[model samples]
Target chain A: MKKRLFTPGPTPVPEEVMLRMAAPIIHHRNPEFMEILARVHENLRYLFQTTQPVVALSCSGTGGMEAAVSSLFGEGDKVITVNAGKFGERWTELVQLYTGSSTEETLPWGSAITPERLKQLLKEHPDAKGICLTHSETSTGTASDIKTLSAVIREHSEALVLVDGITAIGAHEFHFDDWGIDICITGSQKGLMMPPGLALVAISERAQERINEPARKPSNYYLSLKKALESHAGDDTPFTPAVSLVIGLDEALTMIRSEGIEHVWKRHESLAAACRAGCIALGMKIFSSSPSFAVTPVWLPEGADWTEFNDALKHDNGITVAAGQDAFKGKIFRISHLGYYDELDMLTVIGAIERAMKAIGLPLTPGTGVTAVQKAFLGK
Target chain B: MKKRLFTPGPTPVPEEVMLRMAAPIIHHRNPEFMEILARVHENLRYLFQTTQPVVALSCSGTGGMEAAVSSLFGEGDKVITVNAGKFGERWTELVQLYTGSSTEETLPWGSAITPERLKQLLKEHPDAKGICLTHSETSTGTASDIKTLSAVIREHSEALVLVDGITAIGAHEFHFDDWGIDICITGSQKGLMMPPGLALVAISERAQERINEPARKPSNYYLSLKKALESHAGDDTPFTPAVSLVIGLDEALTMIRSEGIEHVWKRHESLAAACRAGCIALGMKIFSSSPSFAVTPVWLPEGADWTEFNDALKHDNGITVAAGQDAFKGKIFRISHLGYYDELDMLTVIGAIERAMKAIGLPLTPGTGVTAVQKAFLGK
Candidate 1:
C-alpha cells in the first residue's frame, strides 16, 4: 500500500528535492560543495526573512534550541520561557538545564500567549536575559502572535526574543528583522519538505554581539554559534554537517522562493481551513481555539477509540495522521497541511477520515467531509 | 559535462540507493520507520562483524569520532594516538581538546603504525586510558594492521582500542569482535555508497559497560553514547535522525549483503590493484608503502604541475579526484575505487588520466594505463 503521510513533521518530501539530494555526495571542502552551501545560505536567509546568516547544524530541532540556549547566555542568567505546548516546554527545560535560572510563563495548552501576558511577565522580571517562544506549537496546533509579542518585549524590557519557528517559517508568515526577533530556530523536517536531520538557526546582530561578548562562556563545543558564524563566512560549518540534507534543503528553498512565500502561506491557510470544515462536517470538534495553518488538531467524536480510529486510517485506508501527544493522547488526532501538500491531498485525507469515522461507528454521512472540503476549496 | 566522482569520502551513490532516498519522506516516529531502523540495525551489525548494537548518528564521521572521545574518557586521562596522516592527526587534536593528556606517536606520512611501535608507546605510558588508531588513513592511502595492533593492546594494557574505520569498514576486511576492537566508527559516504550525513559506530559490550558506568561523566549533550544505547534498544535515536540517508543506507547495505561481505572486500581489493597497476604503467609512483584497498594516492611525476594535471582531468575529461592535504597538497592526487565502483569505472578513470597526462605534457603512452588495468582485471 502507498501510505500517505500527514504528520506535522517529516512531511512528504518533493521528488525534485529528493532526487537532488540523491545525485552524488560531494566532499565538504570541495568547490562544488561550497557552491551548494553558498546557494543554501542565501536561500535560508530568504526563507527566514532575515539578513543574518543562518547557521546549519546536523541534528534535530532540539539541537538548534540547545545551541541557542547553551551558546547565547551564561549561567544564572534569567530567561523567560513561554510554555503552551510540548515544544514550549522544551524551551523551559533547556533554559533550566543551561542557565539554571528561568521564569516560565505557563499557559493552557492550545492557547496562544497574548502580548499582554508577555508584557506583564517582562514587567515582573525586568532582569530576564532572554524570552523564548514557540512560533507554531505543533503539539496543540496553535500559532502564537510572535510579532505582537516581540513588540511587547521591545517596549517592556531589553531581553532578547528567541523563537522556535520549526513548523512556522515556510508555512506561515514570518518577518524576522521587522519583528525584532533576536534568534529564530527551525528544522529541516517541517516546512522545508525534507527528512529529519538538519537544524537551522538565524541569529540577529544583537544575538551575535551577545555570543561574541568576551565575558560569555559557552558550554558546548560542537554546536558553538560563534564558530558556526566564523565558518559560515567561508560558506562552511564548524563541524561536519549533513551535506545531503542541506542539498535537499537548497532545492526546497528554491521551490519555496519560486512559489512565493505569501502563496505558500495562503495554500497552507486554505488547506487548514478545509481540514477544519471537513472535521466539523463530520461532527468532530476542532481541538484548538487558535489553530495553526500548518496542522489542524481535531477531537475524535465522543467515545471513539483513537487507536482503532488511527489503525483503520492506516491499515484500511492507507492513510496516516498523527495521534495526539501527552495529555491529549487518545482524545485528538492531527492532520498536517504543511509542506508538499495540495488540494488533492486534503480531499484524499478528508475522504479517508470520513470513512474511518464511519467504520468506527461515529455518526457521519458518507462523503460529507469530502463535500465540505470541496466547498471550502471553492471558497464557499 | 557530467562529472565522475572519485574522491575517497563522498564517493558515488548507487542509482538504486538514490532512488530509494528520493522516495516520500516518512515520519521518524512511525511504525514503518521503526521497521526500517530494525533492518538497518541488523545490517550494520553484519557489516561491522560484531554482536553489539551499532549506533547511528546524524552527523559526519568526525562527529562519531568526537562522540567517542567526549563520552568514553574524562579530563586528565592519558591516551595514545597514532598519527600517520591527516585523519590520525585529527585523533591527536580531539584527544588534546577533550582529555588534555595525549601522547602522540607521530609516524612519517604514508606509513603505518606497527604493533611494535604501539608496544613501545604502551610500555612508556602504561596509564593510557585509550589507544586511538585510524584503520585506513584516507589522506595517505594507508591501512594500518588493526588486528595486530588490537592484539598488542589487549596483551599490554587495560586501555580501550578505538578505531576510525571511516574509509576501511566496508571496503576492507574488518572483524570487530575477532579483532577485539572496542569501538569502530565509519561514515555513510565511503563504503556505504550513500551521501555524507550519517555515521555509524559499533560499540563492544566492554565499551558499553564503560559508557554506562555510574561514575562516567560525558561532556556532550546531543552525541551522548549512553542516550544513544538506550534509544537504540528501542530502534530509536535520542534525537531525530537523518531519515532519508538511513533509507538510502538500507538499500546500500542490502546490495552489500547480496554481494556478500567477503565478495565486497575482494571487489575493492581487485579494483585497488587495477588502479595501482594502471598508475604504475603510467610511470606514476604509488604514495603509500602499505596502501589501502579504498583509495590510491599517486605522486605527480617530477616537474609536472598537479593543478594542470587535475584541471585537465576535471575540465576536459569531466573526472574529479582528490588532491592531497597539508604537506602533500599539489604533490599527490588520489583516485578512489571505494563504493559503487567497478572494473569499468577503473578502466574509464585510467583512460581519462592517460589523456589528461598527455594533454598536460607528461610522458605517457596513449593506451598504456588502460591496457594495464585490463590486464590486471584479467589477472594477467
Candidate 2:
C-alpha cells in the first residue's frame, strides 16, 4: 500500500532522490564526497538567500535550535521567543536550558505574532542577547512575519535574530540576507523532502564571532558550530555523518534548483490556497486564523467526532492526516500542503474529507469541495 | 572502476544489503517500523551475546561511547581507560569531557594491555567508578584480551566494565553476558556490513541504574542514554533518526543472524589467519604483536616506497586499503577482512597487495602469498 505522505515532514521522497540515497556509501574524506558536500553547501546558501557560510551539522532541526541557544548565550543572558505554537515553545525551552533567563510573547495557537508586539517586547528587554521565532509554526498552521519581525529587531536592538525555518524554507519566500536573519536553522525532512539527518544552519559572521566569545560556554562538541565549520570547509564532518542521507539531500537540492526557488514557493502558496478554498466551499471553518502555506488546520463541526473522521481518512481512504498537537488534539485535524505535493494529491485528500463528512451526516456540499480545489488549481 | 575497500570500517557493504537500503522509507511511528526496531534489538542482542537490551542510536559509534560516559559517570567521578591504541586514547578523551577526572594505562601502539597490569592499576585506583577499553582497536589492529581484563576489574572493584567493540562485535567473539561487560558499544559500518549512522550499545541492569540516577550531571542531552531508552520504548527516537540506514541495518542483521554467531566469528578468525600467513609468506612483518581478526596491520618491508605501494594498489588494481594513522602514517598498511566479506574477497585484496609489492620491486615470492592463503583456508 504505497500511500503518499501529505505530512509537513518526512514528506514524499522523489524517486530520483530516493535512488540517489541508495548509492554506495563513500568515505566522507573521499574527494568524490567532498565534491558533493561543496555542491550541497553552495545550494543551501542559494536556497537560504544568504551569502553567509551555512554550516551543515549531522543532526536534526531541534539540534540546530539547541546549537543556536547553546553557542550564542551564557547562563544569565536574556532572550525572547515568540510562542505562537509548539516550535516557538521549543525555542523558549532551549533558551532556558542554555541561558537561565528568557521571555515569551505568547500568542494564541491560531494567531500570528504582530510586529507591534515584537517591537514592544524588544523595548521591554533592551538587554536581551537575541530573539527567536519560527518561520512556520506547524502545530498552529501559522507563520510569523519574519520580514516584519527582523525589521523590528534591527530598529530596536543589535541582538541576533534567530529563525526556525524548519517547515517553511523551500515552501515559503525567505531571504536570509534580505530578511536580516542572523541564524537560520532548518531540517532536511521538511521542505527539503529528504529523510531527517542533516540540519542546515546558516550563520552570519556576527553569529560566528558571538559563538567564539569567551563568555559563551562550550555548547556541545557534536553540535558545535565552530567544529562543524572547520570540518565543513574541508568538505568533511568532525564526526561520522549520515552519508546516505547527504546524497539524498544533494539530489533534493538539485531538484529544487531545477524547479527554481520562486516557482517552488509559488507552488506551495497556491496549493495551500486551494486546500483552504476547498474547505471553505464545503462550509468548514479553518482552525487557524492566519494559516501558512505549509499546512491547513481545519476545525471539525460542532460536536463532530474527530476520531471517526481521522479513521475513515486513514483506514478507509488510505490517507494519513495529522491531528492537532497539545491542547488542539481531537478538536482539529491538519492537512499538509508542503513538499512533493500537486493539485491531484490535494484534490484526492479533499475528496476523502468530503465523503467522510457526508458519511458522518455533517452536511457537506456534494462534490463542491473537490471541484473548488480543481478549479482553483486550474485558475478557473 | 570497481574497488575493494580494505579499510577496517566501512568495510564492504554487500549488494543485497545496499538494495535493502534502497527500499522506500517508512514512517518511524508506524507498526512496520516498530517491528523492524524490535527485530533489530533482538539481533543486536545476538551479536553482543547478551540478553540485555541492545539500544540502537542514530549516530556514529562515538555517540554511543559518549552516551556511556555522560550517562554513567558524574563531573568529579574517576574512571580508568586503557590507552593501548587510537580508540583507547579516545576513551581517555571522552572521560575527560564527561567525568573530568580519569587515570590512564598507556600502552604503545600495536600493543595490548596485560590483565595483571590492569589489576595493578585497579588496585591503585580502587575507588574508580568505571573501567573502559577497546576490545579491538582498528587504528593498529590490536585485539585486547577483554575477558581477562573484565575478570581483573571484577576482582578489584564493583566498577562497571565498558568495551568499545566497534570493530570486534560481529567479527570477533564478544560474549557480553559471559565476559561480564556492563556496557558494550558497536557501530553498523564495521562488522555489521551496514553504513554509518547507527550505533549499537548493550547495557547491563547495573549500568542502567547508574544512568537512571538523577543526580548525575547532564553532560549532554542528545546522546543521553536515558532519553534514548525513553523514546525507544515507544518505537520512536528522541529525535528524528537516520531512517534509511536503520532499514539497511535491519537487512544486515538478518543476514548475520542467518549465519550463526559462532560460525561468523570462526569465519573471521580463519580468514584473519590466512591473511597473516599470506603476509608472512610475502616477507612482511605484522604491525600488531597480537593482531585483531577484523584487520591485519602490516609493516612495509624496510626501504619500500610507501607512496608507490599505496598509489599502485589503488590505481592499478582498484583496491583501496587504509594507511596507518598518526605516527604510523606511511609506515604501515591495514587490510580488513570484516563485514560482508569471505575467502574470495581476502584473496582479491591480498593478491592486489602482492602484485603492488612486486611492481615496486621489493618482494621475490610470486604466487607464494596466494598459495599460503588458499592452503590455510582449505585446511587440507
Tens digits of lDDT, candidate 2, A208-243: 889777655564556678777778677778877777
Mark the regions of model 1 whose C-alpha exceeds 4 Å error after superposition.
Answer: A22-32, A74-76, A100-103, A214-221, A238-241
Spell out the clash pairs found in candidate 1.
none
Q: Write the per-residue lDDT of candidate 1 for residues A1-380, one digit (tens) a residue.
A: 87899999888988888778876666777788889899999988988888998999888888789889888876689999999999999898888877766799888989998888788888889999999999899999999888888999988899999999999988788988999999999999999888988989999999999999998755666667888899999999876677788888889999999998889889998999999999898888998888999999989877789888988899999898888989999988899988999999999999999888888888877989999999998866
Per-candidate chain B TM: 0.99, 0.98
Worst 10 residues of 2 chain B by lDDT: B214-223
What TM-score does chain A of model 2 get? 0.97
RMSD of each: 2.4, 2.0
Give the Cα RMSD of candidate 1. 2.4
Candidate 2 wrong stretches, greater than 4 Å:
A214-217, A301-303, A358-361
Per-structure clash totals for the candidates:
0, 0
